[model samples]
Target: MENSIQSIPQNWYLILSSFMFCIGIMGVLFRRNAIIILMCIELMLNAVNLLLVSFSSYAGNAEGQVFVFFIMVVAAAEVAVGLALLVSIYRNIASTDINILSKMKW
Candidate 1:
């Protein structure tokens, strides 16, 4: 039983993370909504975080986990700033579409 718990193969983790990252990339590429794009970016970040955690656990080390924590912090800050900008943009343009942003100029 003890060995079974630690026997999870790394390939599973790799496959899962890669799939998630690909989905995120697809979302970013195909979506026109700013909020959805932001969510997709978050998904990509989380996919990388998952990969880091899997590697850390497999290697018996904490460094990857520490890096994940930093990434989380940065992601939080990014969301805050991104949402604030989105709110302001929405107030001005009355829409969340990314194409409208190209017409904006100071």
Candidate 2:
């Protein structure tokens, strides 16, 4: 069983993960709303997480899973902080437009 599992090439996983990452990149590039952009960032993180998990599984190690857990924690914290910042911006600007956020430049 272990030999069979190990025989599966890593490139296949890499290709799929790369595809997901590209899609996430496109979403971030095309989205105009702050919320949507945040979601795209999350998507990208998830894609990378998938790749990490796959690699960890291939290596027969638990470290990848542990790293994934930490990534989830950081991603959650980012979402919380990002949404709060968005709310603060919306309170003052009344819009979530990414373009309009440029005015906040200090």
Candidate 3:
């Protein structure tokens, strides 16, 4: 009872995560900057992570947290590889705009 008293409701988490995910989706769809797109992707991933953690806490289970850890690891790897590619692309074109990347065809 004490634990429940201090914890936030699951519904709140759901709403917040959903809002975050929507923002991420909008950013990805409407933005043209490569770096901004990557950041939006990360934001979407974090929203999912937040929902997972809320569910795990609501159920008193550890699996969600473990999955979140794996997700974070994957996200980190993705960022590393993505940034590397972006660096290579920027060096060639001097721009990070997605629209400009279409000219890279050899």
lDDT of the candidates, in the order given: 0.95, 0.92, 0.94
**lDDT, candidate 3, at 60:** 84
Candidate No. with top TM-score: 1
lDDT tens string, model 2, 1-106? 7476577799988998889899989998998999998998999899899899998988889999999999999999999999999999999999999888785688
lDDT, model 1, position 90: 96
lDDT, candidate 2, at 43:
90
lDDT of 1 by residue, 11-78 (tens): 89999999999999999999999999999999999999999999998888999999999999999999
Candidate 3 — which residues are off by over 4 angstroms?
1-7, 103-106
Better of 1 and 2 by lDDT: 1
Clashes of each: 0, 0, 0
Residue-by-residue lDDT tens digits, candidate 3, 16-102: 999999999999999999999999999999999999998988888999999999999999999999999999999989999888777
Q: What is the lDDT of candidate 1?
A: 0.95
Q: How many backbone clashes does candidate 2 have?
A: 0
Clashing pairs in 1: none
